[model samples]
Target chain A: MTLQIAGGLLIIAATTLIGWDFSARGARRVRDLTELKKSLILLKSQIDYSIYTLPQAFSHISPRVAAPFDEFYAKLAKDVEGGADAASAWVSAVHSLKNSNLDKTDLENFAILGMSLGAMDSGVQINSIDMVITNIDDSLKRLLAENPKNSRMYRGLGIVAGLLITIVLI
Target chain B: MDITVVFQIAAVGILVAVLNQVLKGAGRDDQATMTTLAGLIVVLFWIISYVSDLFGTVQSLFQL
Candidate 1:
C-alpha cells in the first residue's frame, strides 16, 4: 500500500510539473517578446544617433538586452564581424537560439526584419524594426489574453490525468 | 469482480468529467470530446474481461 501510494504521488508530481512547464511557456514568450522590443528600440536609437556600423551596433546592444536575446545579439555581432552580411548573419544568429520561448512565427518575423537591417538606408531599417515591434505587440496582447485560461486548463488536466492513471493501475 | 474495480471506474468518471469541463471552458471543445471518448474507451477496457465472463456464464447455464 505504501509503495503504491508513493508511486502514485510520483506520477502526480511529474504530470503536474509537465503542466506547469507548458503553462510557463506562454509567459516566457511574452518576456522574450518584450525584451526583444526593448533591444530593437535600443538598436534604433543606436542607428539614429551614432555612426556605428551594424556589427558595432550589435556588439553595443548585446550586453544591454536580457538573456537569450543578449546571446542572440552577441552572436549576430560575431557573425557579422566574421564577414557575413547583415541579413545572413541575422538569420544564422536566430537559428542558433536555444530554449527560446518565441514560436515559429516570431522567429520568422525576426528573419524578415534581418533582411532589411544593414542592407538599407536608416529610414528603411527603422521602419522594419517598427513593423516587428507592432507584430510583437499584437502577439503579446493575444498571449496575455489566452494565457490564464490555458494555464488553468493545463494544470487541471495534469492532476486529473495523473489521478486517472493511478486509479486505473491500482 | 472486485469492489475496487467499481471504485476505480467511478474515480475515472469523475476525473474525466472534470477534465472535459476544463478543456471545454478553455475553449478547446475538440479536446474535450476527445478526452470523453478516451475515458469511455478506458472504462470499456477495464470491464471487457468481465463482460466476456458474463457471456461465458450465460452460455454455460444454457448448456449450448
Candidate 2:
C-alpha cells in the first residue's frame, strides 16, 4: 500500500514538472520573436543610414570616401544574400569596418569627428540617427527584461500536488 | 525513500528552469543554456543514485 502511494506521488510530480517545462519554453519563444523584430528594425536603420548619410558625408569629405562606402555596401550585400539575420550581419559588417582593412574606418571616423558636420546642417541628421539608435537600444532592453513565469507557477503546482498526494497517502 | 527528496528534486528542477529562462530573456543565452544543462545533469545524477540503491536491494534479496 505504501509503495503504491509512493508511485502515485512520483507520477504526479513528473506530470507537474513536464507542465512547467512546456510553459518555460513558451516564454522563451516570446523572447526570440522580440529579438527577431529588433534585428529587423536595426537592419532597416542601416539601410536608411547608408542611403542618406553615405552620399552626403562622402560629398562633404574627400573623394577617398567612396572606397570605404563600397566596402560597407559590399558587406551589406553579402549578408543580404547569405540570409543572415539583420543584427548578426550588421555586427559582422561593423566588425569588418573596425579592422581597418582598406578605408573601412573612414566612415566611422567621420561620425566620430563629431556632430561638427551635422551641426553645420542644424544637426538634423545627427539628431535623427541618435534618436533611432536610442529607441532601438531601449526596445531591445525592454525585450530582454521579460521572464518565464513557468517556474514560479510550477513551484506552486508542485506544492499543491505534493500536499494532495500526501493526503491521499495518509 | 523520503518524500522530501522527491519534493527537493522537483523544487530544484523548477528553480533551475526558471533561472535559465530569466537569464535567457535578459540576453544571457550561454548562461541560460548552462543553467538548464546543469539542472538536468544534477537531476539525472540524483535519480541514478536511487536506481542504484533499488538494484542493490533487489540483488541482495535474490542473493544473486
Q: What is the interface RMSD of each candidate, in Å?
A: 0.6, 7.8
Alpha-carbon RMSD of each model: 1.5, 16.4
What TM-score, over all chains together, does every model reach?
A: 0.94, 0.28
What's model 1's overall lDDT? Answer: 0.90
Off by over 4 Å in 1: none
Each candidate structure's count of clashing pairs: 0, 0
The global C-alpha lDDT for each of the candidates, from Candidate 1 onward, is 0.90, 0.52
Instruction: Report lDDT (Cα) of residue A14, candidate 1.
Output: 90
Best by TM-score: 1
Instruction: Please state the error at residue A12 of candidate 2 in Å.
Output: 28
Candidate 1 lDDT tens digits, A1-170: 99999999999999888888888888888899999899998998899888688999999999999899999999888998999999988888888764688899999888899889888999999899999999989999999999999889888878888888888888
Question: How many Å off is the CA of B61 in candidate 2?
Answer: 4.0
Tell me chain A's TM-score in each of the predictions: 0.94, 0.34
lDDT of candidate 2 over B1-64, digit per residue (tens): 8777687677767667666665665467897788678767766876898899999999999999
